[model samples]
Target: MALQIFNVLGREKQLFQPIEPGFVRMYVCGLTVYDYAHIGHAKNYIAFDVVVKYLRHSGYNVLYVQNITDVGHLRDDGTDPIIKKALRAQSAPMQIVEMYARSFFEDMDALGVIRPDISPRASAHIPEQIKMIQTLIRKGHAYEVNGSVYFDVTTDPDYGKLSNRRIDAQQAGSREEIRGEKRNPEDFALWKNAEPEHILRWDSPWGEGFPGWHIECSAMAKKYLGDTFDIHGGGIDNMFPHNESEIAQSECANDADYARFWMHVGSLTVDGMKMGKSLGNFVTIKDALKRYRPEVIRMFVQSAHYSSPIDYSDDAVQGVARGHERMMNAVRLTRRALATAPQTDDGNAILAAVEKARADFTAAMDDDFNTPLATAALQELTREVNALLNSGTTVGASVLKAIAETYDQLGGAVLGIIPATDDSAAGNASREAGLIELLIKLRSEARAAKNWKESDRLRDELAALGVILEDRADGTVWKVN
Candidate 1:
């Protein structure tokens, strides 16, 4: 089957088609860079990361752009979160931006998320934002009042098309305050007049001000990915005013459609409650890495559809971790059997299983990226291969090689839950195995020398790292859990 995506624009599963054949242009709204990234951020980015990887694997040249909002992301009370964080820490706004921007990328890298092709910062793209606002004002889609610009929601009759809300149904001044400067309560700011105490300010035709939260995205997406792109994505929480305003203003200013497909990841909750710092349940990416491997985290996220809400808890992630280990063990055992197996005369049963797993994985992915089902296909293959390997028959080298390749392609490349057993990775594995053997030898020597305290310490430490040492009558053997 061909690829299909649940485009939020139409609220249906549509066949995947890019604006240009053999190429895809995509943009996702990035973080505001005021603090460290959390698990919720990990879920959102990992969803898009897999999308980009799958698109490229399907033979499309993809150019992905994500923006960084360093300024002008205002609260409902007209305060910038960056400035608020900076003041609380007694530092400059740019200092806070620089620190957390690095922190955000570090966390994403640890989670195995691929970086975007272009990361345009809002502060660096002021000229482009100013030009777009000027175009809106000249086209009568916006108005300047008291050195500030507001997008006239009434001017664009299709104002709430994306959110499917009528202008009258929306609470006026719900985001921004009701003021005499706005013609209507639902009108949002295109550019805000910076107060004298504002840390981040720029000179514009309207005065010294900054771009609004919504305009920054519209301007940056237009500049990097063109006026219209193939896909635009972000968290579903931003679908209402942030994404809705982006569509209305971009179409009005450029006289073209904004994005062909809109993809939104569902919100992530912690143990059936919203994750928050005040709630004492916030899981930062850094803190999560302390307890779980990056691959484990990726597997937990892929256990659910990208468009479906997921709950994060220790029990949930621990289950995924065990599943990930099962798959990895299958690959490890297959490679070990391949080392001494005969070259020819193999039955086609294992090879057929490999082919069936590949087809099943692709089919699941094609049906709107149904990752849970795709992973189930992998687990099924793992079970079959494990049974074959443990049976009293010698699997041929060619059959084992085929099984390994399928895991590399489907699990490593597509879902990113399994690491490729390439030369480099194999070398690392060999080194780790050597270290464990050496520790076991030292512990054996200590036991032979009747040093009970030191021997017990070494054995306990290795067990802490999931390496169990069994003392048999023949010798000592070790296994990783």
Candidate 2:
């Protein structure tokens, strides 16, 4: 099935057709490395990560590039964000960038957000940015003002195509004097003049200046993924002005579409307001990782569609944690069944149900990478497997292997909700599984022998070890907490 994506360009869902057959080139706007990444950032990257994962799973060779803005991103007062962080920390701006950039990688790794193939930092691509700015100027779409360059939005006929905002409505001297250096108020900066005190400034054709926020992404994306790419994605907040400026500079300079698909993930809120550090309601990715497992957090992010707002709280993550554990327990039970059952006939109701679920999972993923629906299919498979396990009917080894492999393919390989079954994680998991089974057997024997106090004590002991036990009529079920 051809994947369908909601392209923000036309505000409609369209079937995804890459520029090159059998390959996808994707670029996701990355973060400014001034501070630690937050939960809002987590949702943004994970959304694109799943997109890339599913695309690869569907047999496309994907080249994913996510740029890091260590310089040029400015505050409202026209100061570099990294410079501001440097001032606060009593260190150099690059030091702050290095510190947080390392933390960003660590935090995203913890969240299971896959690293991009090319992590092109803006500071590293200074020459490429300068060249793009020069091209915009040579093409008569930009002008210089006192060692700074600005992209003249009026030069482009379809300036507001990506964002619905009109670029033809600016009247000279009719607006506030916010952008005094710009020819038009809507004209975005391509390069900014840096003061002598600024430490991150580089020598450009204009003078000792730095790349603007919008121009960095334009240059980096073109450098790594070429003028036209399959997908360009970021948070919806980047739709206006930021991404809009990128569209103008890239297409005007390269004379081609900037990106075929403009995908934007929804914002994350807290309580009822946007999550921000100044708002004091924001949760850092560091803090959230301390409490929840990475897979639990992935499940929480995948619970809703990518383009939907997520209201985050402890309650939200905890709810998803329970759901994630249930899914993992189902995988464990299927693995157990596979390990012990005899190799015989596979014709059974359970086998048919598992095959149908595998098909459903693929169908759900192909439809705009609908992770919630895909996860639902897996959960249904779990339910079917649990019923078969408790039906008092012997499930053959072939049937159990099919069920386990199906779960591993869709659950672990595609969605990444399940951990990898290779390496030390698998070894440690096996050890834990054996210990958990022993405890379950001891507790079950205590219950059958009418030793109520002994069973309760054993359950309490397991609880202290973070193992949750559910005693069904047929047997005991256990999952790691």
Candidate 3:
């Protein structure tokens, strides 16, 4: 099947034909960096990360750009997020931004999320933003009011086309109660005048102020990816006002389509409740990595399609942990058998089935990046390899190599849900290794002395620490669970 994406602009699935052959230019909205990145942030960013990974796997030279909003992200109550955070922490706005931005990258790195090719900070791109706002004003799509500039939505006939909001069909706002500077309530701020106490300000032609939250992405994306890119992605919540405004201002300023395809990931819920700071139910990536491994978290996120909402819980993550462990164990088993397999052909029929899973994986991912189905295909490969390995059948050398490649390429490279075979986690266990070795010695002594209770307790304690001990034919060998 041809690749298809559910573009929010069209509100239906459309073939994702690239603007240029064998190349994809993609942009995703990133964090405001006012607070710690939470599960909701993980949901959006991880989805986009998988998209970029799959595109590269499919032979697309993808240029991915994600913006960092260090300023001008106002809350629903018209309060600056960074300023409010600074007040609470007794720090400056830029200080808060720098602190959280570093922590955010650290968290993402722990989760194996690929860093974007270019991560432009809004505060650093004041000139580009001013140029875009100036272009809007010169084209009559925006007007300066006092010391601020607002997009003239009525000037663009297709203002709400992205969000499917018909301008004439909607009731007009009460113009009498003009609280803000905009002539129309639908007209959003392109650049707002910085208040006297505003910590972040830039000298724009309109006034000394920062870029709006929506304009930051447009400015940075255009600077890196050009006027019209292949895909623009973010959370579904962004489709209404934020993305809609992006479309309006960008198309008007550039006099071209903003993004060819709009892909929005679904929300993340915590135990059936929507994740929010006010609700106190959100899980941060820092907290998540402290318990579960990164691959397990990836498996948890990819269990469902990108468009589906996932609920987070300890039980759910534990189930994912078990599933990820099973896949890894199968890889380990197949590799061990391959090490000693004969060079001559054994004509094992299971190898053929395992190889076909490679095609299945490609097909699943090509169909709009159906990662859950792709993961299922990877599991099928694991199962076939394990079946042959466990059946005491030595597969041919070439077939063994094929199985290993499928596991590495599709499972490791494309899905990124499989940790590397030489991952440093094993090396990092030196201290634990010494502790585990001592315990193993004690357990051996207990078994030798016929202390059954003590031996069982030692084994049980190790198991609790995610170290499983198996009594082999010669002795016990421990592997991380």
Candidate 4:
């Protein structure tokens, strides 16, 4: 089946056809770089990362671009979080941006998200933004007043095409602080007049000012990916004013479509509300990592559809971690079996199961990147593979290799829930697995000798270290807790 994407622009699922044959140009709005990336950020970025991975895995040469906003992410009252963070840290605004930007990438890397091909910073592309704003002004789509520029929403009849908002219905000049200067309440800023004390000031056509939060994405995306790209993505919360305004200004200035498909990830919530720093209910990615493995977090994100909200809690992530341990156990055991399996072609059933699993996984992913279904296919295959391995069947090395390759491709490469190595905290290394097996054997001997004290001591020690041993009638099997 061909890939279908839920494009927010048209409000329907459409077949994904890149502009250029066998190539895709995609852009996603990036972080503002004032604070640590939170689980919400992880959900959004990981969703897009999966999309990019699947595109490349499908043989498309993808040019992915995500921007960094160092300046012009303004609050309702004209305050920049970057500047506020700078003041609190006793540093420059750029210093705050640099620090948090690197931290964001660090968290993403730990989660195994592939980095974009181009990471254009907003501050570095002032010329491009200024030029885009100049074009808007020249085309009468925007106007400059009192050393500030605002996109004239009244001029674009299709202003609310993305957000489905009507200009007359919106409370014009709702923000009294900038209402007096803006022609309409729905009008949004392309450039803001920087204050004398503002540290992140730049010289623009409007005056000494900074680019507005919305303009940076439009300018940067166009500069890197052109006016109309294959896909544009961001959080759903930004759909209304931020994304809506981008369409108005870009289409008006460039005389073309902004992006072909719009994909927005749903919010990551806590206690039925959005997880945000302002809400004080957010968990930073670093803090979450300290509590759970990165793959565990990624699995939790994949448990829900990208457009469906997933709640965060300690209990939720713990459940995901347990399930991840079970999945990795199947993978680890298969690799171990490969070393000892017979050479005879007597495992055609397992090979057929692997083929069926591959087909099911691809179909699920092709259906709007439905990760939960795709992952379910893998989990089902794991169950079948486990039963065969534990049933004392004469499985061949070729069958084990095929099973391992399916997990490595669909789970490791596509979903990214499976790591390339078992050396991660989430999975026991081969050496560690061997040592645990040896200890299990010793504990068995102790039990056989009726030395309950030594047997219990070994069991308790392993449990303390999160190695859970299940004693079956045949023998004992262990899994990472």
Residue 382, candidate 4: C-alpha displacement in angstroms: 1.5
lDDT of 3: 0.83
Better of 1 and 3 by lDDT: 1
- Provide backbone clash counts, one per model: 0, 0, 0, 2
Please identify model 2 stretches exceeding 4 Å from their true place. 170-173, 421-450, 470-478
**True-vs-predicted CA distance for residue 144, candidate 3, Å:** 1.3
Q: Distance from true position, residue 473, model 1, in Å?
A: 15
lDDT of 4 by residue, 127-228 (tens): 999999999999998999999999988899998898888887457657676478898877888998988878898998767998999999999999999998
Instruction: Encode model 2's per-residue lDDT on 288-308: one tens digit a residue.
Output: 888988788888888998999
Residue 464 lDDT in candidate 3: 97
Q: lDDT per residue, candidate 3, 1-481, as tens digits?
A: 6678888788888988899999999999989898899877886888898899888987889999998899888998878989998999999898999999999999888888999998889989989989999999999999888888888788988888887886652434546465366767787888998888887888978768777888888899899999999999998888888998998889999989999999989888999999777898878988888888888888888888988888998899899788787788777655655666789667467667876787788788877788889898888877776667666555787777777777888888877787666321233346767788789999999999999999999999989987888774445656685
* Shift of residue 203 alpha carbon in model 1, Å: 0.5
Between prediction 1 and prediction 4, the one with superior TM-score is 4
> Each prediction's Cα lDDT score?
0.88, 0.86, 0.83, 0.88
User: Residue 112 error for model 2, in Å?
Assistant: 1.5
Q: Give all TM-scores, in the order shown.
A: 0.91, 0.93, 0.91, 0.93
Residue pair clashes in candidate 4:
172-185, 173-185
RMSD of each: 3.6, 2.5, 3.0, 2.7
